[model samples]
Target: MNSHKNASLTPRGREHLVKNIASQGARKAADAAGISTRTAARWKRRYQLEGVAGLRDRSSRPHRSPTRIGSDKTERIEGLRRNQRLGYAQIAERVGVSKSTVGRVCVKAGLAKLPPVQDSVPVRRYEKERPGELLHMDMKKLGCFDQPGHRVTGDRTRNTPRAGWQALHVAIDDHSRVGFSQVLRDETSHSACDFLIAALRYYRKLGVPIQAVMTDNGSAYKSRRFAKLLRRLGIKHKRTRPYTPRTNGKAERFIQTLLREWAYAYRYPSSDVRAAELQPWMQHYNFSRPHSAVSHKPPAFRLGFDGNNVLRNYT
Candidate 1:
């Protein structure tokens, strides 16, 4: 992706522009989309030749460079720094190179600091083999809005009245990373139970029967009513160890992604308008957005579907 300074359009926003140009003329579409006519024509030609993928931002880095230090010299520099604990000047002196070259190489190799070696132990992460084997649940409290917040407007002096908070309850499948989210007034036990029921129904409609759920030891998840609901549905309920959220990491990570991509993706005049956009954003997340953890495929692909259509006999 292009840096923010150089980027002219987002992928989705570019798609919207090209779609409009299909019906309207290029100049008019460019005017409507607030983009240059040259850009519109170029992207239109790319769209015709390479489709949507062509409109995506390509890497700006050159394919090759003559000034970069050779691998053997970089290795010698690293060896001197690691064994002798020498500064860039000393290392460069020994390696017959300039200090700036040594510094750049050290920065690229993550040896620019004099800190001690960190423990090399790798963190163990596990995922379920099948969808619905384990579901992670969590709630995120978002600030409510009476009007556009300071993030939308440059002035922070305006007194925005408090209207309360919106609790976003989310459930995600541990295996596929598919998520279900809803905005609620509170995170009480009753609300949690209702959200669970609705989430289970939504997953069931997608052909996955949930077997177990994992949550933090929150008051709502620990309530008798929630336990009773789980028992009635024959779904095992598990809680993470106190103060160790990694056990429920899936839901935690989903909440982070939700906040970055959807909740703050665009400015809204009110929370109600933001809430209204959640369902469509959720649909796009499930069916279109590529996930890094799942080999860059959308969550729906792992959930035994191609987009919204079910692919039968998929395990």
Candidate 2:
């Protein structure tokens, strides 16, 4: 089955050549095969030593490679990648190999890429069993600009003067991953309470009643007004551990996703323009965008609700 581009004699042809040489001599066999006398002799010698095996096209690769990186070095490179989660350049520097070689080694070792680094210990991930069981509440602060900032416009100098700061109040259901957000004036207790009320109404419209709420130990959330509002609503209010934001990881991660997909997703003429887009973005996020943690289905789908309902209202 082996093929050669320039070879005049295949394995069968070489066998014929050897037989011809045995009967008619090397000169006639070489002439018949259209090969040199030296080639005919070489084929005859190969047939004598290896029978048909040697004539069946041997491998052209050298048995040994002097310049190839050693297995020990490749192991070291992969070790750095798997154990330390080093990038290609870092692994290469540590293992004394080229960055490309380190990348290849990592790929071959099945350790080429890793997940993003975590800020805390490997705590178990848990989701509320029911959509209305718990809700995560948090506030994200974004810098207000007169015009699109560097992240949107690409050129840092193209932006107008800084307008001020904007507080983004975000609420997400733990089980369904449904979210609601608003651009607020400040992070005061009154603003937080107002956002919470609006968020509750939004979820209520979707038929998911709120039973419990979790927030970071921010001063605003700890205020008596905020506590009173929660108490009156008969909703259990839990604060995350001091200095441990991951206890409210759902809202934290949601805000990060919002910043990536909405806040910086487009170039806005002004802060007002960006703020206006939040409602539409939230609709898409809840009804259309796939949530990776939830089996790549939208939030509404996870809650056994038709996303088209939200889309219908949007239209």
Candidate 3:
């Protein structure tokens, strides 16, 4: 049992009180211990009968609870929760019990929440051996705002008109998680091709030559222009299966980090200011920030560069 902060006695303190009682009578011990004489006498008797073990706190649960729900009803409640995935109200209605009673039964049986549905295909995680062997590419659409949105000002009426949208194109090495991103006007095939070229050039500077690129089956990726650019660069293009975003999970994961760290990280005065911040943030992400995928080392470390060297070259 956990003692409250204001509790006067613990198991050890109780033992000390028992010792005091043996020396000076129970009345005097009770006065010194700041407990009633009855309580002191009870502890003394318990210590004498069971020694140190009796001084420890015991469960306050009663030995018998006549009003407790029966075993049959509890089994029925657990069965309904497990088989039918029923809520407390539904289970109570079907089992002819109060909703609170059903909740208590469910909590006792460890069925307070339902388990996640198991997928038929077991998740198979794989990573490329080299940084450039496979690169994951994806895009996220962000609202271009002139001022802080309702999230900051808490004024829903102060909305910007024709704020438009910016497409955030992201590319990341499957192995190192070294990422590059650009905020473009649209997510068209032409914009995707341009971002790919810029990302390729950036990776080349890091000494990582691109071999293959994996992207979601979007219209931009399916366009002939995007395909032609990849063909011209002699890089293989891999498209994720339709409706399965996890196939391009690295890029998706990178976008989530980017959103949290850079995109919505601060309240920018305007879209241009947020766009200007992207380059410096990307530099930090690639060279300074520790990546969990790369064993808590910066993504640059996976590219065979030490801290001092990376700072000198990239900074």
C-alpha TM-scores of all predictions: 0.61, 0.70, 0.78
Q: Comparing candidate 1 with candidate 3, which one achieves the higher lDDT? A: 3
Per-residue lDDT over 1-315 for candidate 2, one digit per residue giving the tens place of the 0 to 100 score = 568698787888888889899999999989988989998999899889999898888778999988789878877886778778879988777777788888777778778767567664888789988998999999988888876677855687775564778999999999999999999999999999999999999998888999999999999999999999999999999889999888899999999999989888787788888999999999889888999977898888876766666554455
Task: Compute the lDDT for candidate 1.
Answer: 0.88
**TM-score: model 1 vs. ground truth:** 0.61
Candidate whose TM-score is highest:
3
Runs in model 2 lying further than 4 Å from the true structure: 1-13, 23-36, 57-123, 222-225, 239-247, 290-297, 302-304, 307-315
Q: Using lDDT as the measure, which candidate wins?
A: 3
Q: Which lDDT tens digits does candidate 3 get at residues 1-315? A: 898798778889899999998899889988988889999988888988998999898988999999887889889999999988989999989989899999888888888988877757778799999989999999999898888888767899987899999999999999888999999999999999999999999999889999999999999999999999999999999999999998888898899999998977888888889999999998888888998888898898888877787456564
Query: How large is the C-alpha RMSD of every model relative to the true structure?
Result: 19.6, 5.9, 4.3
Colliding residue pairs in candidate 2? none
Candidate 1 C-alpha lDDT tens digits along 172-250? 9999988899999898999999999999998998889999999999999999999999999999998999998877888
For each candidate in the order shown, give its overall lDDT on alpha carbons. Answer: 0.88, 0.88, 0.90
TM-score, prediction 3: 0.78
